[model samples]
Target: MAVVFDRPSLWQRVRPHLRGFDWLLLLAMLMLAGLGLLAMYSSGYDHGTRFVDHGRNMVIAAGIMVVVAQVPPRRLMQLAVPVYVLGVALLVAVALFGISKKGAQRWINLGVVIQPSELLKIATPLMLAWWFHRREGQTRAFDFAVAFGLLALPVGLIMKQPDLGTAMLVLAAGLAVIFFAGLPWKLVLPPVLIAVVGVVLILAFEPQLCADGADWVVLHEYQRQRVCTLLDPTRDPLGKGFHILQGMIAIGSGGLWGKGFMQGTQTHLEFIPERTTDFIFAAFSEEFGLVGNLAIIAGFVFLVLRSLMIAADGPTLFARLLAASLATIFFTYAFVNMGMVSGILPVVGVPLPFISYGGTAMVTLGLALGMLMSIAKEKRLIQS
Candidate 1:
């Protein structure tokens, strides 16, 4: 007698790998990615192979996200320290002998040219979350201090590279982890008050502080120029202030309903600088207008909220902290990019998530979101 054996088809064989993914998270990502493609096609129509390269980058990012989603959060905790160490080591190497492009020494030549600062974005959070996880239920001021130490090392290095935008992102990621891990309100409020007061003083003394030959010791010359330009773009509208002025003009030109796709004169005519990358939001706003901006914001809001919910459902303290902190990376990316484009913040090289044409940034975004998906997937596995 011959026995018939059952064979699993391709769908059945692959189903397990696809199971437990957060569909809502994926939906939000897809919506934003679709928007990015549209924005890129329009803004990068004549900008070399940017549109094609962007599409290729998105595909690579999506593949990475899917693969990273399979890694368990518990396994990721084990990786925290080593990844952090590797990131720090690479940063040191960059400082000693790194590539400088456009006056920023932020990239290191490691076989293939790489930006070590981007690694810190994820590593800093992972290290802090792991620290908090180990100290859970018994965390103290010293633990928070250690956490800050882990955070500050990379942030300082990035600043030395003088890439303030990347430093701010790394700092924000670590702070989110610490805050979620039960940092004291007393420690938080002082900085908040100081920052508010500092802003007030800056605005009050804009003219004196921004006068030619005036210097802000804490900021690099270019950074100072950015702040001064932000204060008044009309000062040298054709020189240092051109970016801000052009961005404002493009944004305002969109009015309520945008200029309709590729018809954006500012974008198509090359008036909006970096229209395919950092300032793509201006390009997007020019074409899609206020309504489009709202939709973009809403998509981000959904993604962030969904990530926090994933954090809340996390099975372990490490998972919760990592997920929450990683989610805020998305928040920082979107907020800073949009604010700078809208002329409310400094142009600090931050990219809008899924909407900016950047290989490094998109890869970092994929890895961060993948970690969140892993946490959410783990929770589902536990429940099942």
Candidate 2:
């Protein structure tokens, strides 16, 4: 008897791929993005086109996530070295001939203005993860030393650009990779202790350290002012402290429920600086109040927890390290931004991951989320 063969249709061929996707993670992301849109609309109501532009950015980010998620983790590992090398080279180029804006040489012009440090946010962890993966069963102290050297180069270069916020994110991401790679706590505790002591010393002698013509040897003049301002914003209420003071007032005024959507007095009256960007959380707080803030925090917590779960189930060391480090990036951005706006931390330019309105940051976040999805999908496929 002649055999009759039947070919699977297009939908059937694609169905297996679709089934591997992490729908729960996508749902969590959508929830956060929806909340972000609501907050952006309220904060940017008077600002021209900000709400529209933010929506566009989110759409672009979603596209990026979808495309990136299709790539397998092994292919991502292959790109690690090239990406890290190119990012570091661009940092060097920026040091030589970058565009200077507001006294910071952070952007490099290559037909399009690009911040190379942003690349390192992803590349640092990727390179470190790749490094550890190569040494998987044979990891040694020397390997970690090399990893630290690789990490410090870009971080040092970015700090030279004087972008503290980006530097912090990069540093935290790199450290997360190192920590997850089995770096001993004995090595980690010393740095933690030193940082704590340094902060205490700076706060105890703020008046002297912040006095006129006093040069903090390690920090720039403006950086020193930021630290002092965080300690006591009222000292320069109308000058250096204006942003923090206004942000705190807007947040405190929110009370239990809030003033209602688009009804923030501090935001409407132009008291909150960078209302649609770095300080948007203040406007969100004023409009949505404690309940909204808690909800938003819950959403972020869920996202972070979900990402960590994916990392725990990652099929390889590289996948695990990369996923965990990316989770830390999300956590650090949220923690630092909220702390800065609420007057507990020094005001740096870090934007809240999904809630803040910015194209580059949005795209970077999408890339991180996409990588997580890729890792999760790989785990699911392996199990099946």
Candidate 3:
């Protein structure tokens, strides 16, 4: 016993706790981190202070990832209810007396002006997973409805704040939980059907509903204009459609092999807006071209696949649901950024995960990655 207690190797202690470490996932995460740094450096070249700020955020994010990876899923489950409740309360706070920015109030100052919706991005899934896990083996239709109500509550509040993008993200994260919880396909099909119909209706009547200088139903005028601009960017080439046009030009200008790094005329000339944030992909594409785009896409695919594998191997229902939701969230972030940069979607404020320059988003993504490591770690422990 004395021999065992004397100077035990650090690996011995870490080995037992990290039995579920997925080396593939770790490698994928590291690859993404490297890509993030490269992209940040290139994107921040023209903007002083941005490059250094991005580096600081990266370090903070890495530290968060390490800390989150250590927490057991069981502890995550325990914190779910409180986190959700607090998130809801914060959303309400945002609705009332929140900080206004660019014609939207999506923040509140609690010694700092922070976006509470980001917290819900993580808390919503954790809470819903806990709820579904509680009803395991006996999940009924009403229970599912109640679960959706729980899901919709925060989404409704977020949408009320007119933060359509974050609201969609929160909604997606909750639905992922519902899907992983094995909610009936019948229930799922209806909402999807309604959404399709709603989109079609919007497009069909877009001209009358979105005509210039017309009042919109609930969406801000700029939001409606963004959608209209997506359909016909050429109509207002030098106006609202400027962003889409510039992004498309930058992407298309990059040939099969690209013009070479930092050689993009549009990017260097500052045609692309938010080059370090939402539209950073355009800068990357301009610099690296098709091959670079493929590489970035492949990296994203590997990350998503690894996350799904982790979800599949999680030791508990909560871990599985949380992992799957986070995986989809990662996919959403990539999809929105790519879609906007390629002119297929509206230029919302969605940032490219890990690569975009924002401290809150960086920390949020880090926390998600950390949770993934925790789930993977638990799975490894079970396997051994």
Query: Per-residue lDDT tens digits of candidate 2, residues 244-307?
Result: 9999999999998989998999998989999999999999999889999998899889989999
Positional deviation of residue 250's Cα in model 2 after best superposition, in angstroms: 0.3
TM per model?
A: 0.98, 0.96, 0.93
Q: Where does model 1 exceed 4 Å of error? A: 1-6
Predicted candidate 3 versus true structure: per-residue lDDT over 153-225, tens digit per residue? 9999988778878887888889999998998788789989998998898789878766767787778777888
- Residue-level lDDT tens digits of model 1 in 1-384: 999999999999889988999999999999999999999999998989999999999999999999999999989999999999999999999999999999989998768898999999999999999999898899989999988898999999999998999999999999999999998999999999999999999999999999889989989999999988888888999998898889989988998899998899999889899999988999999889999999999999999999999999999999999999888999999999988888899889998999899898899989987898899889899999
209: Cα error in model 1, Å:
1.0
| Candidate 3 collision pairs | 20-376, 20-377, 20-380
The TM-score leader among the candidates is: 1
Native-referenced Cα lDDT, model 2 = 0.92
Q: Rank the candidates by TM-score, best first.
A: 1, 2, 3
What TM value does model 2 have?
0.96
Instruction: Give the count of colliding residue pairs in each prediction.
Output: 0, 0, 3
Cα error of candidate 1 at position 220, Å? 0.7
